[model samples]
Target: MGAPRRATLRFTSIAIGVALAIVASPAAAFCRSTTCTGDCPRDADGCKTTGKQLFWPGVCVGVSLQRDGSVNIPIADVRSVVATSFATWSALDCGGAAATISFSQLADVSCHQTEFNTSAPNANIILFQDTQWHYKGVDNTLAKTTVTFDAKTGEILDADIELNHAYNELTVSDTTVVVDLQSVLTHEIGHFIGLDHSPDPDATMFAGYDDGSTNLRTLEADDIAAACAVYPPTRSGKCEPAPRNGLGDACGASAPTTSGGETSGCAIAAAPSNTANRLLSLLGLGLALRVRRRDRFRS
Candidate 1:
């Protein structure tokens, strides 16, 4: 049997919901999210751990915002924050040449649910749960990111970002800050790509957050190194932002039903005829257990 698909749950704190061992190289301090479990293999430098590293096969990825805005924040402000968050990564400079990744903002979507469709088009959605945050750690959890990828190749198929506006106070203003929206989204975007938490406590991919702290809004040296390593300037791929099948707007009719095998926190859904045997892995980040509050910073 192939490697079983599974989901990883993380949050902006010291505690990660799942048990994922970080294996880093002597030279680098960042970790890449992998597909396999335990120590399967390693690269020349030992920077990459076992299993295939998760990555988007194409150069460009598309993201859609849910039409329903947050209870406190407007949809326009949310869109602006999302754009800025993606831009922070897209604008990365890998020692002059830019990181080989880009994001395109698709039209607003009506579907608020997060799911992957094997037989239909899909959109990488960003939604806010204003009414209720259904996950385990509601009070401390700020947001959750769900990423779906192919088990064999580690090609990311779909990703979704859900904000915990119901339980926590999420603010978008730069001057007056609570749980900085851009900072939270930027960190989640790191997970959305293929990065695991970094050992560097100051790095954007670090599994910790400071309330009213905007340090995560920009990439640190470690964060830049991680981005450059995963998506180098020489990497080649078409600028395809649409999902596997195509761009989808709704979730009801297009979402596929589960079949075949099952794993913890992952759905064993049917895949397209061309990609039948390959399994898809779904990882959910943002445990929401605790939020470390640091001295507030006003910009």
Candidate 2:
């Protein structure tokens, strides 16, 4: 690809909705990544059948937390959870294995929407939908991660997270019945960074999540290995932990109580593309494919 040109592209992982508490419902499904594949090693304990999708090796990925928080938890606490989730993914050293990419926490943004803008600056945001979770009909989703990438080589250009706060209750406490915000963030961050669900029941990337389980808050062997494969410890990228759009970590504003509105004036969510879908099918992950867009990449 030549000098990157702004293109309308999109990828999505459904987190569903906000719940009052995590009840013992049916087993929750796992995550998916369009960039990852099944050419995986079998020796890792938790890595059983999970494939790998990684960001380009030489860029310091910047993540930003929106100033929105669930009614049940403080926004600052939510930002802390986002930071720790990034840390867990970046700190993987499973013995000698290393992750190629690293993350820097950018400043907080006023926009609580997930969007990639070519005309204006945008932050890779993690926003809480306090009043409404908007998707077709899947209301049970807890959160969703959207990534825009170069479809040709799977080079990630931008990514964002949206937490469903309108339909359910979410918190950062250890109440055991409530959805662990930290645990869900950790899992969603996996998708933000390019990971699909693992076949291993013990893996954090496993598509299956149980209510009140904290295991997903940390990395499993498979999760570590997958991170290592995408970003080795030896790769090169500056450690820039500053917000790209000049927003700061100030929690004075309450996320709007309305059901729907624009978070940023510059971004529009791109729809899925058929070409990307065919490519995912060729990769043996058509069943697990959650995102597809052709303009997101250049051959």
Candidate 3:
């Protein structure tokens, strides 16, 4: 086998958004995340239009909340909020039928590291960075969602959410909140499921977030439309939520260990892409197959 390699991209740019009144139908303005970046000149709303639309090619996807929630919030509270935030999307009404997509919350994982293991089992993790914010613009950026996907088919392989609790106050209450945790998760969840920032300001997938505002806790018309469109009721697939090879809570090749300490050789074929307050880029790694990383930033 070839030696493993790593590639890192520096994200220090700012993506500023100015909220504007919508002149078009709000339901018609939702944006889908593509394999291309924001610079791609395809979507007229400055969303994505030029590349393959990113999506999970299955009916069910698995999600794992890090066992260590956050230093400022209780683990139970974090679990509850995370569950509710994802549930909100799973139960979307697509014209009397449920959307084709569903999520299975695998047991809380001990792995807090954000990565896609090419030669071992993996988990789609949602973790809080309470000790340090490792990205640029620590003060204004609230969170980031990193999606690992197949560039050729636009199929999502693994996704992870990192909350910037180290630099900002994240609250759970409905009133007098500093930064509502549910709102942040819900918006990030959109990115997790392959939705981009919508042109409509009222959408839960909007690019800009208002502090202390819980408006993103619920989906708007645009969000609903986007969900139904992406995962229509007639979409054909089974509800298998296990991550690529299987779910492993640890951070490396030795994950899901037994007495024999065996590991699988299954690697997800990919190319790198990103998204952030909201950074999204596509990264290319030197691996056997092309692996892409996608990320989105929240402010």
Candidate 4:
């Protein structure tokens, strides 16, 4: 074959190879729906499944106590929980408005006991025979609680504190402090949101609790990505531009700023066309193939 014909054939072969690889990749497949259970490795199907629960998109706004002696959990902690939990969703491409905990406004807060109360009869209790407490007695016990919120508004109307007094029964070691607070909070926060027990023991959202260990601190990419998807920042960040009526600001323009006695506005522009050049090159390969086929028929 002539050099020109050989080059054309090579180009066509390369284009076909590139297109096939793109279509065959895993990302081309739509994710399957499957629930993750205790200790199971994330799979394409199981990882993609999400709960039907809908959360309101707004910052966690308030935390305060009621007239009663019961402690009111801070909305800031609730905000942190939402931030950490929805982190998974944001990493994924799933579309939704991001949820936030707003501290801007004060709101009424209340608490109720849901489990393991020492005051109640027949309550399961863990007694520490020794007076030795770890980390100023804070690490001595592991307590868990759930505070439910209104669907429309991310308000904490009630909380249930579950305490494992036996936490005090364990001997204090160097690893205990690091593991106790991080693991427990990560787990309880999982429940605070809509996630149920994950069958994967290694997962931070796992159902059963383990002793002092740092394994749960790092969230699985799937979990965080899923949470982010539920509360996407894109939809959450958009706000209607303030009306120009009686205001000196320009309509549909960014906030004005005075620098060196000069006004400036900020705007975004589209990126330059690198992909367009690549597409044109690919099309040229197709044209070369057609020309070669026509020459072969003429011969």
Candidate 5:
């Protein structure tokens, strides 16, 4: 029998990516929301854990990229952002025999939607949505990641990410009021790679987000530990850094920018919230601003 499915979490610019355990829940709990549920996989001894560490077949993974970018930025820069964001985790020095993370581009896809198909070659895709933004509650969300895992063993089957471009102007420029596309993707990639939220507010996996911050673009200490714990260097497997099809970053016949050819732009959009400082102090607001785990899926 096929494994059951769990709920998913979506991403946003202002507030994005609350950590989750991919727990089996009723249909009512499956509806994504903006409130933190404080749910995570835990040991019977009470230690926190992810729903499960991802088990990559033969320790290799292939990802598909949408060949297009939102009107706010060029396609080249979008691919660069993805590469940079992914490299942060791939190049980590996990002491020794670590489960090194690596990525290679699949054929660039024309379809920017997020889904998995059993009848066809399913893709682990990351794409941008520039025309329409849809989700429950507020429309300020920046992106969302859908992770499909085995309901029985909690083993991840496939994952996809979608970026919201219609309401927000995204950019790769380091100096700009607009949101940093790389920063947002870095966080979602955490979810994409099977990480849940961290209790440390300063950690990148924390549910709270600080706009205009660049620290998240790189993996923090906590982020590294979570990955290392799952794919430790001593784990039993060979690490291969090549893609299934080829050793290039071309989406289909269209090639993407080289690692050095990163693009840049300004997404002059939302103003920093006046109360951003208060929200940053998640515990200061008492019950109103509780540091709860927010659900980001829609019914």
Candidate 6:
């Protein structure tokens, strides 16, 4: 019989309300609201303020996984993965910040199932496996937790990777040449970096992979915004906020309060709240751009 299907893991932060279930598929679902929920606390607007609020105060990051049972990718290609991913996220109007890609030494081939225990999560490492043989349509997966270190000492304790079921046919070649390693890595990395399934038919982060769109190698605005929210740029190098069309304000500015209450500069300041929102927007734009760019070159 096939291996037991892993249960969907859920993360609940005090910042956001909805419980985000991390499914073992590339196309995971996300809450649509901008605020937090449940035990997740929120600002005056009732948004949850836990994990999403903490790590992704303004921007989010994306990561790609290394395939299991495939030839090890050279360090150069790994660097390329980092560079291309960051570039894709740099073109959005969200907060001007850069995204990062980190590498891990552990191989997913360990294939040893880990039991749930109290350990820190590792956000930098990615594990790849071919789930296609067991599950016909499955491609890649990412775990839904972040890796954090002790604020004072920067020590790591645990990490997570979304479970993937299909583990065969990931390294097969058509003409005796190795299948495009970069292409597959790019797709898995998109998930590691926090891109959701794209509705755009031609986006690299799109739910399905099409050979015709192999070079769809850019990030969409959404992807950028997400990564930036996770890892924002420094103030000295911060990109100027983009103008909001018809909104009559800069991208991060608050709406005019008709009641004349105190305007908390949280939206404009480099402080945490403003930074968080800006980052998320940046990541979203980044992903959107990658998709659009890939479509452009492919066509």
Number of the top-ranking candidate, with TM-score as the measure: 3
Where is model 1 poorest over a 10-residue stretch in terms of lDDT?
Answer: 289-298
**lDDT tens digits, residues 198-257, model 1?**
645556775556555666788887788888888999999999888867887788474463
Clashes of 1: 3
For model 5, how does the per-residue alpha-carbon lDDT over 49-154 read when each residue is reduced to its tens digit? 4433444443545677777766778878888888888877674677655555556666676656654443234566777878886642123556676666544444
Cα error, residue 32 of model 5, in Å, equals 18
User: What are the clashing pairs of model 1?
Assistant: 10-286, 10-287, 141-288
Residue ranges of candidate 4 with Cα displaced over 4 Å: 1-57, 61-143, 147-161, 166-174, 177-179, 235-299
Clashes of each: 3, 20, 28, 29, 18, 88
* TM-score: the better of candidates 3 and 6: 3
Where does model 1 exceed 4 Å of error?
A: 1-27, 37-48, 252-299
TM-score of 1: 0.75
TM-score of each: 0.75, 0.64, 0.76, 0.36, 0.66, 0.37
lDDT of 6 by residue, 65-151 (tens): 333332444444544554553455443444443353233233222322211122212123344333332221223211122233222
lDDT of each: 0.65, 0.52, 0.66, 0.30, 0.50, 0.30
Candidate 4: RMSD over Cα atoms?
24.6
lDDT of 2 by residue, 1-299 (tens): 11212222221111222111214321222333543334433322112243233364344677777765566788778878888888888757845656666788876677766555433455678888877866532244566766665545555556777776666456677665456677777877777776665543455665434444465688776677667656667767766543333333442144322112111111112223312111111122233333223332433
Q: Model 5: residues >4 Å from true position, as ranges?
A: 1-58, 238-272, 277-299
Per-residue alpha-carbon lDDT of candidate 4 for residues 150-185, written as tens digits (9 for 90 to 100): 323332222222333332322223354422333444
RMSD of candidates 1 onward, in order: 11.8, 14.9, 11.6, 24.6, 12.6, 18.8
